[model samples]
Target: MNKPFLRPESGRLCAARAAFSRRAARVVQFGIAAACVALPLAAFAPAAHAERADNDKPLNIEADNMTYDDLKQVNIFTGHVVATKGTIIIKADRVEVTQDPQGYQYATGTSDGGNLSYFRQKRDGLDEYIEGNAVRIDYDGKQDLTTLTTRAVVRRLVGLTTIQDEVHGSVITYDGQKDFYTAKAGPDVAGPGNPTGRVRAMLAPRNGGAAPLTGAPATLTPSTKMQGTQQP
Candidate 1:
């Protein structure tokens, strides 16, 4: 049987949880509470707008092995799968992709063993990027939504380095169209590091007069070579 991610109650665990609560309180004082509403803590800010042309771009994937089902129009890639669509990139141990009749594509990525799947996408017309990690990541092309489940953590980075904001929860649903996201807390995220398993966020103040960072169009390079079996 697999062990739970959460550890048993202990004095050390309680202290860690208390420290986390204090940090969360400090984060709220910084700015999270201003943009977030209570009960699961949803934030609506002027960030996280994904590249507009990403939806039109073709989905490219590389993996060590692949299985394509023509009747179902599904492609499953396993072993170090790296998928790219425009400025968006996802890396996982396994990825299943399916296309709709209208040409839109959907993808689900799963982690490799205990490691979490990774996702990154550049913000439209800005020098910022949105990155996330989770045990499972589901991307809906038609709806322009990315849902991260199980120990989800999402961050907004200024340029390539500076982390402007971040959120943590058991599940996070990011709507690219609306440029917003909602997070839910649950037992899946309950661990020794977070005993309460509550949603936590650190938001940067937007009242500064500084203009949004703008730059030339960003490009993504596939991480690995495409060497896999494909049957049509």
Candidate 2:
């Protein structure tokens, strides 16, 4: 398999199409609706098998709004733009969740009834459940996390500005929200003439985290995941 690209200089990601941060996030997408359901553990084996390699595309979901309500009938949250199940954990800005006559539920504004997925798992090593904007998760509800699809990316909190992406299909995972990260591409610097798949530093790495460098640096790893991964 081909080695992956690391966060190169601005010019490099534009050329190699690897810098997810700088690239236009026209993500690959599917939809999830408003509902909460759970899947069992057996469904994870195949998904695990799919993750045995690192060279596939990712799962994407787009939405304008998402909400989860209980049977009681109350609003949760609104104004979310997009949610992704990429090489990281589930992310959504405008997210609302609640419970109803049935149980915990989730809803989005996409189709007035968007794509939604539900599953039970141990979150952050604690017993909990997850509702999505549309995903089906299967888990043993145990020590390890079990995702049910080949398209899902697992994310783990590495640090305040770092989250590791352990993708099933890509040799390269992103160390988002930072200028400096360790790419499997090895330690190197990016520059003109030498680009693409080369792990290089940002020629002009903007300090997105310039507040105070509150915490320590987060490390990236191959097993950085969501269901089976640890939270910071």
Candidate 3:
């Protein structure tokens, strides 16, 4: 009987091939896990369409008291301030506004004590609106961006009552031009409900229908004229 002979190099080659196969299998498993994690986020990544005409409108502010600094070109409003520009509305205990040389406006709204500042804007040609609450709110007219800082909660509403989607974070930045928003997590938003201070979002299905949301709803109405003193 002929003795079976196996080359030493052949056994080494077989072992190397087995190791590569195991690594490739693990890589495929990791890819599948990553895709599972990304699918839910991608479903809600559609861009919003905000009102384009609001950019051309003027800023109108109402407050209990107003002070204007001519040299600095700034207007400070205090005591229940409400500012409106086209379909956009901002409410806070204090608001500071400044206009640039090119006629673009910037505003910073802050709440007193433990109160939260409010912001709302209508969507373009739709019955929907975007609203948010935070400790501080900033609006940039030139870039059409809104930033909410510290315990921020933003929501998408249908017909001023039904909430379609909601997001919570320590800070949220909304870009009206791009119709998208981003949220960041921080310790400021950590609490009993969210101890880890992670960004949370609740998105509704896009079934071309509005569902009734449970809870008392608030309404926002835009002012046609300025309620505070306008400094030239």
Candidate 4:
């Protein structure tokens, strides 16, 4: 399998078009909604096989307005768009999805309002969860890469309160296949009082006290998902 792209200087993802790993390719084929839901877990843990399978489940979306341009092969969802797959959830003002002729998918989500686009996902077989906020998020299903840009902040938590890891940067990128990530400052510094344009990260030491995630739902079964259709 090809290596996923790192955060490039342009603050945009530039993943090479190549075949994905067996695991990620299956997740990609499951559909865009499911793929987008699984891309935010780099802060929590290296998603195990079970986690990737969870992402292959059905993707549900809610939005005020949506449009699909068949000619251009682009789907756009706007106005309080919320997408969910299994335990993962994403909320933004607008989201755009497009596919390559080869059936690879790309998704971009942006928050037009003051608040950043939000993402949350439960860790595989763990009490911890991952959450993030960014002005925009980009996912490349062909490469199993997710990029967060503009005042990006990602955190890992245990039991909804105890933080396990946190990262702050202008751009943060995660590789789903390898469970690797890179963070850096963007050309334009964003966020409150971040004039120095530096990346800040706080990764909690392993073996820290962690409590079980009470009331968390059990894992859902994976299934062959319908492609490209919007959810009500």
Top candidate on TM-score is: 3
Please state the error at residue 16 of candidate 1 in Å. Answer: 49
In model 1, the worst 10-residue window by lDDT is: 219-228
The reply for model 4, stretches above 4 Å from the true place, is 1-50, 100-104, 187-194, 209-232
> For residues 5-84, what per-residue lDDT tens digits would candidate 2 score against the true structure?
87656876566766564444433111011100111122121111112111122334454543445565644433443433
> How many clashing residue pairs appear in each of the predictions shown?
0, 26, 0, 0
The candidate, 1 or 3, that scores higher on lDDT is 3
Where model 1 places Cα greater than 4 Å from the true spot, the runs are 1-44, 207-232
Q: Which predicted model would earn the best lDDT?
A: 3
lDDT of every predicted structure (CA atoms): 0.77, 0.28, 0.79, 0.65
Q: Cα lDDT for residue 195, model 3?
A: 58
Residue 79, model 2: Cα distance from true site in angstroms: 3.1
- Predictions ranked by TM-score, top down? 3, 1, 4, 2
The list of candidate 3 runs beyond 4 A from truth reads 1-48, 208-213, 216-232
Give the winner by TM-score: 1 or 3.
Answer: 3
TM-score of 3: 0.72
Model 1 global lDDT (CA atoms, 0 to 1): 0.77
Question: For residue 199, what is the lDDT in candidate 3?
Answer: 65
Across 17-95, the per-residue lDDT of candidate 3 in tens digits comes to: 9999999999865643443112123235355567899889989999999999998989999999999999999999999
Give residue 146's error in model 1 in angstroms: 0.3
